[model samples]
Structures are given as C-alpha cells and as structure tokens.
Target: MHSFSIILLPLLSLLPSTISQTSGTFNAMTFNVAGLPAILNDNGVPGDKTANTARIGQLFTQYNISLIQVQEDFNYHATLYANDKHPYRTATSGGVPFGSGLNTLSNYEFTDFARVKWNTCSNIDSADCLTPKGFTFMRVKFAEGVSIDAYNLHADAGTTAADTTARASNLRQVSDYITAHSINNSVLVFGDSNSRYTRTGDIPSIFSTANGMKDAWLELVRGGVAPQAGTDALLCDNPSPNTTCETVDKMWYRGSSAVELQAQKFQYAGNMFLQENGDVLSDHDPVLVDFAWTKV
Candidate 1:
C-alpha cells in the first residue's frame, strides 16, 4: 500500500497545471448595431435609435458580455450608449462626425487605445465611400503583467470584385498591425469582417496562417472540425423559417503557449436584443462567445 501511494502521488504531481486551476472565463461579442442616422426610422429593422440603444444595454446585462466590438455605431452612440455602460471604452470615426463607426467597449480598464483608418476603400460602393471604415486597437489589462490586445474592425461590405479586394486589403492591414503591435501574440480580432471562412480570398487564410488565430465560431461550434466553417445561428433580423443566415460577424483569438484558450460556448444573441413587438434591435445579429483561459 505504501509503495502504490508513492507512485500515484508522483504521477499526480506530473499532471499539467490546467488540470488543477483555471485562470478565468470571459465572454466577447461583435455586433454591428446598424445605428446609422439614415436608417434609424426605417421600420423595425433598425428600430428607434434610442429604444435600440436601450436594448443593447439590456443585452450586455443579460449576457454579462465583458468585451464588445461594435461597428456602424454612429451619432455618438459609443459615447451616449456605451461609455456609461462599459466603463472602459475607445471610439473613433476618423475625426468625422458619425463617420468611422468603430468602437470597442470592455469591462476592464484599457491600457492603450488607437485607431487605424484604411488607406483605401471601395470607390464603387457609395456607402463605403461615405463612411470612414477602419480598425481600432485596444489593450486591456486583466491582471498584473497580463494583458490582451483586441482589434475591432468593419470591412467594406459587398460581393463585387472591388468590394472583395477592399476587404482583403482591410484584412491585410489588420494582420500587419497585429504582427507589429500584439504583445505575446495574445490577441483577439472581432467585428463585422464581411468576410467568411468559406469565402475564397486572403482574408481567411491570412488570419489562419499569419495571425495563428482561430475563428471562435468554427473552432467551438463544429467540434474542432478543421477546414469546416459555417454560422447559421441567426441573420440580420429575427429567426425565421425562411430566413437565410450567413457568417459575417466573427471573433478570432490567439493565445500564447503558456495560456491555453478554449471556447466554452458560442451563441447568437439576436433574440435577447429583440423588442417586445418582435422587432430586432439592429440589422446585424450579435455573435457571443464564452472563452475559458487556463495557465498551461
């Protein structure tokens, strides 16, 4: 009995630290609020900006989503709606009033914040031309000497060749920024990418290879099914039998070898943001992902 106990104790001590303690868990979401000034009164899709803003706050409370990346948040929505709610925030629209439409809100205090406007955009798409689309970088300190870099972006939206090219360029800029700025390679890029894993382009490939990041939805939902990617949880509006869903809003993460990142759960929070009359809060559904981090 003494000999057996000695051998078992040594084997147990050899187990990885992940088997003993978990660092923490946090939830992240990427939502395109579609809070543009022109679309605020356009029926139930956009809904009333004020009411929709309230619903957005409700979503944060209901889900306890700690980190959020919002796109198309114009008209001081980031300041009026998010600043008071998130506590930690960064927002910019390229110095234009209601222009860039990118913001990052976090439960943790931000150590650093910056915005990078795209050098080029789709000339054919008037919407893209009017709005100054770009990516925002945020550094949040979770603990002493522990931080994560987050990049929020909203790429050009369209299926045309010019639009696709612009999207690829946007992705490249993001990748380059990550390469240059991300400390310890622990980073997350989330927002309305307008590019999918199934699409044929450098956007997906650049992230998979250059950034060493995995799509949170694909990595967690499909049971780690390599090369398989799809997000049909919810589309622009409420869930319907005839509604066709696609993967547009997404989250990607990369963790160092010392820190193991696992996706505990992923869901579409469109239902939570719906009005009592069944109207959606925004034109784009929010993608929420819960992640568990452990020291390896």
Candidate 2:
C-alpha cells in the first residue's frame, strides 16, 4: 500500500505540468519587398513584378510562415501573392491615396484591423513623401481561445536627423496604440524599422524599454551563436560590397506573465530565396522568427 501511494502521487504531480505545456508553435516573417515603383526605378535586382510575386509566394511555403508583415508593398503585389499561395484567412493592406505601404498577412482570421500614418515624415528625401508610411495593427487568433495583436510598421528612411526623429515618432505611435488597445497585453510588432539595435539612441531600444517589449532575435540567438550588435546579421537591400552590415528589419513582442512567449529560432532567409540567375527575391532579406507561447 505504501509503494502504491508513492507512485500514484508522483504521477499525479506530472499531469498539471503536462496539460499546461505549449499547445503549438508558429513562425513569423517580416520583409521589405521593395515593390514600390520608386525602389524599382532605382535598381532592377528583383526584376519584373510577375516573377517577384511568384518567388515571394514560394517563400511562404519554404519558410512555413504563419504570419507575415511586409513593407513597400504599395503595388498590391503582396495582396495578390497572399491570395494565390498562402492559406491566410485574413489580411489588411495599408490605406489608399497617401496610404502607408504596410501590409499584414495572417493564417488566422483577423478580428480587427487598422492603420495609422505617421504625423511626421522625412522632409529631405523626396521618396519618403511619395506615399504615406506608417503602421498596421491586426488581431489574430492562434489557438482555440488565444489571440494576439500584431503590428506591421515602416519608418522613415534616410540618414538625416529628420528621418531619425520621424522613426522615433513612428515607434511612439505604435507603442501608444498597443498600450491602449492590445488585448491581454499580448502584442507582436515587426517590419522595416530603419533602425539598428547597435545604435545607442535607436527606435528599437526606445520601443523595447518604453513599451515592455523584447526583441525576438536578441532573446533567442540563432544556432546558439550570439550576434554581433550591428554587423553580424544584416538585412539590407544589397549585401555584397557593403562594409557595414546593418539590421534594419526586426521583430518584437510582449506577453503577460500567465502566458509567456519565447523565440525558438531567428535567422535571415536570404540564400534560399533567389532567382535562377542568383538575383535576390527582394532588396532586403526576409527575417524569420519561430516562437511558442506556453502557460507559465
């Protein structure tokens, strides 16, 4: 009887932990597709719209991406691609006219979707004025009753002080929006920040510290190798002939204590996504992050 009681107690203790373990995992990706006409006019790397759209579709299968955030998709190329390849049930494109080039694609159905254009933008670069650039917010369900607020953003691009300030403002807008609207404080933000983690006063640092969000890449270094601040992982348009490799694309998220989120893997999906002639899929390398949510 004593031996039977001991064994029964041990098995009972394991039931709670096993039942509370993570139910599933999902993968997310953020890429600046450079589909806007301005970027294409600058260089012909990605080539024709039809071919670029096809390659983008193939990447969804190659990476098994569950959620995607894309910037510079002003041409509606992302919308067409998502419809043809991915099984995304819900999607939202940035506003029209002076709409932001941001777009969010998700496997789960979206309960709510919205976009906010930055009040301030880069005055120095004429390209920045071409279209309104901002962030898109979406609510997606991952499990039976689990959902998260997802944000896709594209900040001002340029080296000038105005660009830096505009980028900071964009981060502030996103942070404030999530704080006020996010359900359960579970939020995921990803896109082309045009800011670097290595920079002292960058938008990434500001958003994380001020909003209680964590950078997925820094939290989970790929291959167990710690990345060098700026140069280790570069997601720029052109990798070759570039001395300083900067990480402009990023992913960040926040989850309540009851449900903690952890990044399982983080990497740049560049080599695999390329044309037969070796031309890249997009100007910027698509960044992938595999993460799981578990009960604490």
Candidate 3:
C-alpha cells in the first residue's frame, strides 16, 4: 500500500490546481462616460454630461461589477468619483488639456501602474487630441498569488484616412507595449478602442493575430467568428447585443501558460446605465465581460 501511495503522489502533482480551491469568476466593465464640459459635450449625446457621469459612478456598486476601466473621464472627474465606491482605484490625472481622461476601479489590488500617451493623433477630430489621450497599464493581483496585467485606453477617434492612420498607430503601440512588457503574462485590455471589426483601416487583428488575445464579444457572443474586415452598418440604438453588431468599446484577454483565463459572458450593458428619462449615460455602450480563471 505504501508503494502504491508513493507512485500516486508524483502523478497528482502533474494535475491542475484544485478547482474548488483556486478557480473563480469575475465581471469587468469598460465604459466611456462622456465627461466633457456641458458646452463642449452638448448635442453630442443624450442626457446631461454631469448628471450622467455622477450616476455612472453609482451603477458600479449597484451592478456588483468586480472591476471597471473608464475613458473620457475629463471634466466631470469629481462629480463621478463622489458617487463611486470602489475601495481600490486610480486617482484622476486631472481635467482635459492636462489629464489623459483614463481611470480604473477594481476589487483587486494592482501595482506598477503607468500611462503612455499616443505617439500620434489626427487633428481631424480636434477634440480627440485635446487631452494626453492614451492607455494605462498595470498588474492586477486578481486573487491570492494570481496576478494578471490589465490595460485601459481611449484611442484616437474619427473615420477619415488621417484619423484611421492615427488610430492604427494607437493600436500598434499598445500591442507593442504588451509584447515587450507582458510577454507570457495573463492580460486584459479594454476601453474605448474606437475600432470596429467591420470598419476599414481599423485593424482589429493586432490583438488576436499579434498578441493571441481573444475578444470577449467574438468568443462569447459571436461564436468565435470575427466579422469580415470592411465597412458595415453599426446599429447600437438598443441595449440588447446583436451578433452582427459590434461597438467601439472592446475587451481583449489572454491567458498565460500558468493560468487559463476564459470569458463566459460578454454583453452590451447599457440598460442599467441609463438616466431616469431613458437617455443613455454615455454615447458609447458600457461593455461587460465575465471571466473565469483556473490553473493550467
């Protein structure tokens, strides 16, 4: 009996960590709260920018989202933070003309936080380049001894050739950063990408083909088939997510050799973010992804 037990001990070490002990799931959201000053943001989207951002803060706790990454948090920084309740969060850089307009709120502790401004931007939009405008990278301690890199960004916006070129540069910059800094690390990249699968010149394959990251929307909601790269109608008037319809807000994730991260659910969660009058809190939808993790 002792001889049989000895042989079994080594074999058990080859198995994955006990699922009940170490595996779990979490929900992460990416939202671009239209937070420009009232005059500048007026007529762009429905609802008061101030009121919408303030309420946007409250929904985080109400929905019990495990973590969040927000963009366009420029003018209404204080208004939104006043109502938010995340114990772990990044301080606002400041208002635009000075701030990058990016922030993160998480249930998990994170470290090595850093921000990088885009090397390029197109003046076609004018407003997109008003801020530092780029992405933030950090190492989030997801669970005891389980760490994953998380990134939040607001890329260049517009549809002109110059705009698309700048946006492509933005995408590649993030991809290069991941390649250099997060090699072989589990990572989650989300925010207002402003790049769509069906949009020409938006180069969405950098994440999948270059970094091996999986798009939550494509994997969970679109049956793993990426929409063909070309221009298509984007119908985002409703809260219900359509298989064919993709939004600018995107979430990309990848698991390392030690930990396997898989997204079980991906959704356009705008219903809970609407004002009492039914106007949306922001022009872009708040995308939520539920991820499950286990040792590989």
Which candidate number has the best lDDT?
A: 3
lDDT of 3 by residue, 1-296 (tens): 99999999988987765433477789999998877777766636776677777788888878878889999888899988888888899998988689998999888889999999999998896567788999999998877678899999899999999899999999999999999999899999999999988887897779998999999988887788888876576556645445357888999999999779999887789887888888777778789889999966
lDDT of 3 at 269: 90
What would you estimate as the lDDT of candidate 2? 0.71
RMSD of each: 8.0, 7.2, 6.2
Candidate 3 residue pairs in clash (backbone atoms < 3 Å) = none
- Candidate 3: worst 10 consecutive residues by lDDT? 235-244
Q: How do these models rank on lDDT, best leading?
A: 3, 1, 2
Model 3 quality (TM-score) = 0.90
Residue-wise C-alpha lDDT for candidate 1, range 154-219, written one tens digit per residue: 888876788889999999999989988984657888898988655555266577688888877767
Give candidate 3 misplaced runs (Cα > 4 Å).
1-21, 238-243
Give the C-alpha miss distance for residue 4 in model 2, angstroms.
36
Clashes of each: 1, 0, 0
Candidate 1 clashing pairs?
93-100
Superior by lDDT: candidate 1 or candidate 2: 1
* lDDT at position 179, candidate 2: 74
